[model samples]
Target: MNDSAAPVAGKTGLEFALLAEDGPARRGLITTAHGPVKTPAFMTVGTAGTVKGMTTEQVQASGAEIILGNTYHLMLRPGAERVARLGGLHRFMNWPGPILTDSGGYQVMSLQELRKITEEGVTFRSHLDGERHNLTPERAMEIQALLDSNITMVLDECTPFPATETEARESMERSMRWAARCRAAFTQRPGYGLFGIVQGGVYPALRRTSAEALIEIGFDGYAVGGLAVGEGQEAMFDVLDATIPHLPRAQPRYLMGIGKPADIVGAVQRGIDMFDCVLPTRSGRTGQAFTRRGSINLRNARHQEDQRPLDPDCPCPSCSDYSRAYLHHLFKAKEMLGPILLTRHNLHYYQELMAGLRQAIEDQRLDDFVAGFARQEAEGDIAAL
Candidate 1:
């Protein structure tokens, strides 16, 4: 996991290039301490230092240039200090590629009654061992530094959905103040970058204020947060509409925790350059397969004797060599291979979609690409051939 050997000479420390654009959609590149990531990219979530069922090599092979880690999980388990002593997150997780770590503000908010928020920070009980922990903007920076995260996300309140403009404004203002602290706490390095998150629920005015505040504090990247909590896709996009126009185009725009395949497509079209979600791998474990036309449940009886690939267009090892019948059998028999294979295929599907999006942006055909995409989805999966 050592990319420390890459020549740092002449490096601008977290450089970015906007290569192409079609409407609001963009194709960009982010240069990190470890390497460069092509955008619009989907960062596979590797919360707790692992991407669940897949190995690091498998994840890389699936076209993931970057993966995400949660500050809360790592800080709770092996402890940030322990990881630093062992050689940081990339080395500890056996992943050499770039890693982005969330500031854990969202998880702490989820604690509800188990936590208390003050002007300085949020104090919460660990879900792992019921231990008490406090997370502040400064401490968040410290934890990410200890983990040696390439992309450090700032601590921000994840405003709950359906909040009034007043409530949202207060929450968003608090996050803006924390963003200032995070910027101050983050140590500058050659290729590392800290991203400030915009939190204002679904209010356009509040979203603008939050984005403006973060931009003032400055960051290598900007993320649209707090929408995916419960707000539907349209609402999320509305926030992005109001927020992204106010963001710095020179830097990357990341839509946090957003979505299904359609959601990613929409966000990428709306100027988002990065994403992270646990849907693909999690659904795989439950016998769900994400195909071009939508998701299919392998647990269904129709798949018991259906001798076909999960997605004929898919080139993943699972689809290339396995049949729907065999996959159904694996799940029915409770074979471990089912989840592993499904996860591999799902990741491949996601990467392929990203590749297509990048190509579309490069060719200035994003509109056409999106139309064809929706048409395919509407047509549904090819009849069991």
Candidate 2:
């Protein structure tokens, strides 16, 4: 294994190589300008230009090949123009690896109040200052480019859950139109690429139409959005089944903000190459840790006298050196190190899970691997801490 920490730099261009295919699950490699990212990879979200407590070196050590940057957060805080002038996001944040930027569409809809949508784009007030802002498809594309994002997402209105079929169809159609405008605005970069997000709210036919329209416009990748936004797993899986087949197999498929271990496994079984979520990091900060067996809450009183590591099977720094009793004390004392250590452990666990999934796919044993994982999960949550 190449363990060197510095950002690997070279030629750009995504060369997605399918090494193996087990049912819909696949083992592949995504070569980017900075380095090669093994799929199915889970990108740690570094919203606000940082991955919470993790240093870039620590993040790399946790096995993340790429990190996600949020356009909305960066644009609001330090301002995108300032970032551009300071030599873009990579230099601004001191992370030289590849960064994928969201188009700020989701933030505009979710974070801002009284949002008004129109054919041109969305008009909403900034959650930070109540300052008015307009985010059109073209402007979103331009903003990502200005940030020098290796991968940029198209601006799509993330439809809220419990939406009626009529509302879902209308939202899907509008997203498709924005996708077209996003495509037209994107400038060609050898290694950089644009991705179109498919939104259909829980309707199968609408998902198919959205997928087909996005494929027509064409992009380096397709992301399934609007799922996981409060829709249960069964409902989300139904939409995936309806949409994945319509997408081109050669390109990568990303499932945005997708979920727990079970959720990731199900999506991989249905064909997804990339994923991103705040669950692991955020949960860690709250004294929760993920393990091979299941999730464990470190804040539970039962761990006050426990001598065991968080997970004996885990090879992370926290598991290697810290005892559950020590961790419990830290949390009980409200120490910042408690969350930091747990975050590292959670990130390590997620990376290990992804490695296991990739190996299983390559060995054509995904079904068996998934079955074994389910069995482990059934073993119940880890003993407190």
Candidate 3:
């Protein structure tokens, strides 16, 4: 696993070995240049090179084997070239684990007021200082390469919600073309690989076309993108049902920016092997904590006098050392420790969830596990230890 500049041929830079399956759930191994990440793994998002409110060590201790980097944010703020000079994202951010960098498409597209889309690329103004910038597929590849991302996602225009079939088709076709360009532009190395995103804006036929197109282009992994943007979970699942079968069974399948716990379970049931999202960390700062039973809000008055840990079954530092009373007081006082502890707890919970999912798949008890999970969730977050 050499993630450094020197390349090794015949090594797709990433190797995936599917070891077991329970229904559509997969228990697999992903060998990256950095290290091995388990399938049905959840990548804690360090969007701007850091997960908010938590140190890298804390993040790792929470059981995250991999983290995600954002190309757009890095390019605009610290600049990708500067990161390269600083020895790439992992070194710059001081995160030693595998890092997956998005293609910068979603960020650019989200800048609706500042960006202009074209067949070739997108021209956008930086929200930081209103600086003009051009983001083509080639530039996207270069930026990610400079960041030294272990997994590079190809640039794809995130089709808007409620798009017409014709509109979605055009957007998907454009993304497919960009995916090809990104593939050509990306400099392959051992332990690093490019992933092509499947985009069809909730249209099954369009998804099929997009999936087939990416298959033809051939990527280290295939990612289902453009669905979790605004679609409800049911619609999202439908798209996955339509798309996953077309992707290569031998390779890894990534479902980008998805979702709540239920959404993840569903995607895993549909054969998604990898996932990344900011929900856990982001929700933490807002006083919400994810527990095996359900979610809890420290800001709620009911927690003010509670003496229990966030989750009795949890073994995270936050759950082990802190009480709901203390956490509630911290949030009420607007103390920094509030977000930090909650973020740590949330990340740990997410990792624990993934571990459970992997184990369930390996034991071929995924159905039982998922059923129990749903029941516990419906039982809601317990107020007492």
Better of 2 and 3 by lDDT: 3
The root-mean-square deviation over C-alpha atoms between each candidate and the true structure, in angstroms, is 3.4, 3.5, 3.3
Candidate 1, poorest ten consecutive residues by summed lDDT: 1-10
Write down the TM-score of every candidate: 0.96, 0.95, 0.96
- Residue pairs with backbone overlap in model 2: 12-191, 13-191
Q: Summarize candidate 3's per-residue lDDT along 107-146 as a digit string, tens digits.
A: 9999999999999899999999999999999999999989
lDDT of 1 by residue, 1-385 (tens): 1223243223235888778889999888888889888899999989999988899999999999999999999999888999999999999989998999999998999999889988898999988778888899999999999999999999998888788989899999999999999999999898899999988888888888888888888888899889778778888778888888999878888999975999999999889999999999899999999988778899888898888899988888999899999999999999999999999999999999999999999899999999999997788765552
Range of the 10 consecutive residues with the lowest summed lDDT in candidate 2: 1-10
lDDT of each: 0.88, 0.87, 0.90
TM-score of 2: 0.95
Regions of candidate 2 where Cα sits further than 4 Å from its true position: 1-13, 381-385
Q: For model 1, what is the alpha-carbon lDDT of residue 348?
A: 90
- Clashing residue pairs found in predicted model 1: 13-190
Task: Give the TM-score comparing model 3 with the true structure, all chains together.
Answer: 0.96
The TM-score-based order of candidates, best leading, equals 3, 1, 2
Worst 10 residues of 3 by lDDT: 1-10
From the highest lDDT down, the ranking of the candidates is: 3, 1, 2
Where does model 1 exceed 4 Å of error? 1-12
Error of 1 at 312 (Å): 1.2
